[model samples]
Target: MPVGYFVTGTDTGVGKTLTSCALLHAFAMAGKSAIGMKPIAAGCENGKWIDVERLVEASNVPAARELINPYALVQSIAPHIAARQTGIVINIATVQRAFKALQEMAEVVIVEGAGGFLVPLDDRYDSSDLARTLGLPVVLVVGLRLGCLNHALLTARAIHVSGLSLAGWVANQIDPHMESQAENIHTLQHRLNCPLLGVLPFSEKIAAREYASLLDITHL
Candidate 1:
């Protein structure tokens, strides 16, 4: 059976891609064939999305580009806005079909959601709705910094409210200078009601493969 997770962040620029790649590497390390999916990628350069490229690089299995990233929009902004500018309708069903196809090729699939948990996909559907539609357990990437407490709590609450399991969370230390980092993590561990999968400290450079070894996949 194909099994995996939906990786979402508390907010954008929170290392969702890094976490996704790390998860993929973790699965690969476990001797499982894994692939990464970016259902909706808004940022594009030249012709391809930077994040999707990185995801493909980290996966252990090969999947069709269209299936791996169904919606690769041109503009680097909100998904809904990018869809509008490109005259494309971001359909949940299309993404679902793509996910199903990817499942045929790999034992584990990591689907990375765009932006925050509640970010809009279209006027009618957001990332939350997409997660509900997919029915996958969620792994949140909490960017450790000021105001993370509120963002992480709100995102976790929304995930639960939407009727999905908060499988676990990754603490990505985005701000090296942020005060009371350990206390912040302690507070989240007490309140989030899920496993703290790993704590990623701030690094000037990140190699996803190297970072993958740091994450424990037992809870995942």
Candidate 2:
């Protein structure tokens, strides 16, 4: 069976894609064939989702675009709204089928979720539902900024409630100027009940491959 993870964040712009790409590189470093999948994505530039492209670039395993991103909504908005606007239904079955295909193509598949864990995919379902359907361990990316403690704690609780294992979490230092960043990390380490896989420093020009070295994949 392929080892997979559902990557979600505390909130949007919390470095989920960056963490996902770094995981791909880290897995590759560990001599495992790995590919990254977005399943569903909102926002596109020049007819491409930037997150999908970044994942592809970081991946060592070659996969078809369709399997990597089953639903690539053009608008940069909430996925449910984007889908509704484009008359596209966000189907979990379709995503599952694509995920299975990716599983066959790699030893590890990193499935990156859109927005937060409970962001609605459709009126009837949300990202948490998709993670449950995938049945993969999740890796939460807690963006280190103001109000991180509440967001991280709430997200962790939700993951547990959803019956998914939070394999580990990455602390991406998104705000270089945030006060007491180390204290914040220390608090989460004690409270989250999971290993701290990595603490990524803020860097505007660092590549994912470089960031991969900072992550400890052993926790996952």
lDDT of 1 at 85: 88
Best by lDDT: 2
lDDT of 2 at 156: 100
Candidate 2 lDDT at 97 equals 98
Give stretches of model 1 more than 4 Å off.
none
Backbone clash numbers for all candidates listed = 0, 0
Clashing pairs in 1: none
**TM-score (C-alpha) between model 1 and the true structure:** 0.98
- How well does candidate 2 match the true structure, expressed as C-alpha RMSD? 0.7
Give each model a TM-score: 0.98, 0.99
Score residue 19 of candidate 2 by CA lDDT: 96
